[model samples]
Target: MGMNYFHQLLCRSSRWERASATQIVPWALKGLDLGDNALEVGPGYGANVATLRTRVPALTGLEIDPALAARLRTRKFDQLRVIEGDATAMPLPDTEFSSVVSFTMLHHVPTPALQDDLFAEAFRVLRPGGVFAGSDGLDRPTFRLIHLGDTCVPVPPATMTARLTRAGFTDVEVHSAATYFRFRARRPA
Candidate 1:
């Protein structure tokens, strides 16, 4: 994951944290049951950890950056475990989590192929009938500007259903606004 210094600062900002807690997480997870075990992919700076940990009995964060993962571990988020690993190839066992979520992080995966692999990995870790949900911003000028010198292959909402379906997901639901998109899908029971 490539994070420019400016982007890193923005992610750690209070405004971003507040929006993640009050708006982003809730909007992506509306009407979704996170079940007893939930995994959050790419939880940079752990901005959403506080809110996500509350929704699920056990919440694990899978971060690719070792420093960020260590940072999260030190924060001592109750009911949260920080794991340093790539989402495309998580080290956890199969059929582990009941739900998988990634928020505003897909574009950082560098390529659509890896992003699709992450989707498949989420399916691999989820038990039968498990849900995979999250939100990502649509490609826009401001989004690209913040990601200058970083990996930013934005996932276009129109292509989401096809991609998730290719990863063996069912009940795929994609909702998009002018700037961002939210999605939900289920692994077949």
Candidate 2:
């Protein structure tokens, strides 16, 4: 239900952070389309918020941390909508977004049930054909890996596909490299 400290240590290490700048950002950016309305979960530090808004003018950021949400307000991103809410229980209506993207936050979910809720919520909010891409550091032998305040769930490609199918998403694709795993799924039209 929580992140392992060791994984956090790995993420904070200079080498990991440096490598992420090259590996993670570009891959995450590929999932977003500027013309579509988007929703981001756990917009930590608002790092990707600016880039997201540039592509999807109606980009909404949902975070559970009040302090981070407050800091996000400092930017005059007129098109950005920042909301304080749980990813497992979003406030918006169904079919509310054209895309839903979450990165490195899946492992932070307290439990697998919560993780299921997150996937369900994302599906509920996405229009048919809407894309949902979420990435996490789970290239481990067990679910004991940790990153920052998140836990790696040891989700391989098959498991990820099954999880997406159970959540009512079709055409699931799992792309991974070393410490990164990105699950790209779509609501069927």
Best-performing candidate as measured by TM-score: 1
Backbone clashes in each candidate structure, one number apiece? 0, 3
Q: How do the residues 1-189 of candidate 1 rate in per-residue lDDT, one tens digit apiece?
A: 888999999998889999999998899999999999999999999899889878987999999999898888987556488889999999999999999999999999988899999999999999999999999998999999999999889999999999999999999999987777999999999
Local lDDT at 135 for model 2: 77
Task: State candidate 2's TM-score.
Answer: 0.80
Off by over 4 Å in 1: none
Q: List, residue by residue over 74-144, the lDDT tens digit for candidate 2.
A: 66356578898889999889998989988777867767778889999999999998998867766564445
Q: What Cα-based lDDT does every candidate model obtain?
A: 0.93, 0.74
For candidate 2, what is the lDDT? 0.74
User: Which sections of candidate 2 miss by over 4 Å?
Assistant: 1-22, 29-35, 76-79, 139-157
TM-score versus the correct structure, for each prediction: 0.97, 0.80
